[model samples]
Target: MKALCRDCFWTGDEQPRRCPSCGSMRVVRHEELGVLGIAHLDCDAFYASVEKRDRPELRDVPLIVGGGVRGVVTTCCYIARMSGVRSAMPMFRARKLCPQATILKPDFQKYRTESRRIFDKVRDLTPLVQGLSLDEAWMDLSGTERLHGAPPAVTLARLQADIEADVGITVSIGLAPNKFLAKIASDLDKPRGFSVIGAAEATAFLATRPVGILPGVGPVMVQSLEKSGYRTVGDIARADLRDLADRFGQHGLHLHRLANGQDSRSVNPNEARKTISAETTFNEDLNRAEDLEDQLWPLCEKVARQLRAEGIAGRVAHLKLRRPDFQIVTRRRTLPVPTQTAKTLFAVARELLAAEPKGQPYRLIGAGLSDFVDGQEAGADFFAEGERRALKGEKAVDILRAKFGKGAVVTGRALKKE
Candidate 1:
């Protein structure tokens, strides 16, 4: 099949602006559409969409989900996005741009729950699913046509429909010959979009695009490349590989390969997450350990909750402090046993904080867990009876929190004085 209607799932060999069978303008046509199986699926405005789903009244209105005025926006609905509000923009600025927007504090627990439901649906289709975040993932349906009795494209269309039907959320999909191109295709169209990229057109498709579109080519790298007379992907593709390597080292060689539409990376389902962490910049600098500890408590809980959600435990607890002068101080402690409990993480982080010099003001303090192992492997025989009991109690609290809202169970340490 050379063409498929995203809305109707009609397949044909001819390329048309609209599907001949269903008349949907959302038609994806490519030379390799039938052969390509690597895919990327990204939720559309994930956080905001979840909020809107829970509150149907917000569905048609502009919405922004984030922290307080002093904080930054996590995500905004398309209506707010059209008014210049964007993710990571200061809340104050976003409000100014979309004053009518309904602002809501983020409920990560809710988002995580919804994300898990969506991921479970994806996993049902293929075992080779690689989760990128709470809302995005990469899947390889390379050889599942016989099992599903349909091509990968048709299976993905059904998956998209299933997500919307069951999860109450929309997703955009990209099908391509490789991961890099699949990622690029996923962004070509968004908010319930389906796009495809094929091997035959990958090189020419990337040529006119800016080099910055390639992964890892940030603003600084773009400026450096432009200064060296390489302004576009086409330029990088035509440049001498040896010369590019000499100038930018291995990174240049990597860029050259990507520019020519070459990426050998596979979608590994068992890829290890380097770290799981949570951090927040304070509205004001904190000098006392008590104040820092209060802030650190919630962050530790957040990290622990993430570990539980991912079904992993960490062997190292990490503490990070940022001084007022922008100097960063990081401390790590290797635990005797891996843990996924917030109480254990906070205890270790608190000790690490106490070991630091007193009266040194910090603008930010964060906590993290690293060196992950399966959750079953954590808190094994190495943990004492008391520790095991504490873990059991914490797991019970987790169940309560999941049943109700996150506020269903709050530790005293996480409580804030009004």
Candidate 2:
């Protein structure tokens, strides 16, 4: 067993009620403390935490970070979460559940800046940082003990403390022998926590848990598994791998391995991005194709901005629409060649949108680009001459927008209409 004082960073043996040196009670003790290397780090209510940090008035209060009444909650503070508020819950419903909570708009740019700063701090601890998203990642701190003069667990705890002190945010970490188990452990504690699950207790601990606890098992798959009489990890663990494979095909093999707490997936730091996209839900459902195009244009611009920032281009454009009745329809079209301009993206997306029978109102719209390649291959001759001209115009506009502001350069039609 090992015990460490969080405040003073003191590592010692006895698990005293208080740290012997600093006299602080925020002490953490664990059996596998020093040996574990892989870790999963997730920020504590990230969007909401940033809001609380910048606006101290909302610190102790229940807070939600989202959009208009029509939009959904991007995230909420723990206090709001206690009232059944959750991420992706509609803002209207979240407000009714916690009527007194403060509601704030999401400032994505500010959040991105802070996320990078926090990531840099984590990289200082280890280079095997596999970012899962802006607020979560898997990090392998193997072979770091010689450099840090401490075990991976202690280094991780100190990293969390450093973020809280310097970045004004707290994170929860999960430590285990591999990526999957480490990710599961991280969620066992939250807000500001460090939890561990070692190889010794892994199988036994996972046995009684529901099959839904596995990473890829969603509600639909859980229902299917339950109907087949396999309700828990123990059931799958006991079942024959061949039998599972016969039932679920390739996925059954995956299930059998995970049931025994075996994960072959590694922490990949250089995972390629498959797609980049953004979507927005309307305050009132939109029916007209023109109205949908209005929403689609901005999303395409956003995707183009990301493409430029990443220095990549994509061959295919994707468009998504959700009807008022919750039926989702998606369409994708590959260009004659790849292009990154917002003009080309919108042209392709506009064609797809025109083909959809659009009398029914749409609650959501999204645009994305995929099938990536180098952005240098994206300019003239690859697309229609009209599109080529628009690309040049958009590039000039992009520069002007960067010099001034996005509002300074807007499409003539869009400005007069909106």
Best-performing candidate as measured by lDDT: 1
lDDT of each: 0.89, 0.87
lDDT of 2 by residue, 187-299 (tens): 98787988888887888989999999988899999998989889999898888888888889889888888888788787788876678888988989999877888888888
TM-scores for candidates 1 onward, in order: 0.88, 0.93
Distance from true location, Cα of 188 in model 1, Å: 0.9
Q: For candidate 2, give the lDDT of residue 348.
A: 89
lDDT of 2: 0.87
Superposition TM-score, candidate 1 onto the true structure: 0.88
Q: In model 1, which regions exceed 4 Å deviation? A: 219-227, 281-283, 308-310, 320-336, 351-364, 380-393, 396-412, 415-418
Clashing pairs in 1: none
Tens digits of per-residue lDDT for model 1, 1-418: 8888877799888989989898888888887888899999999999999999889999999999987765679999999999999898878799999999999988887998899899998999899998888999899999999999878998999899989988899999999988999999998888898899888888899998999999999998999999999988999999999999999999999999899889999999999888899887778789998999899988988898778877899999999998877778999999888888888899999999999999999977889999999998766865456557767887888899889987898777667722
TM-score of model 2 relative to the true fold?
0.93
Model 1 lDDT at residue 184: 90
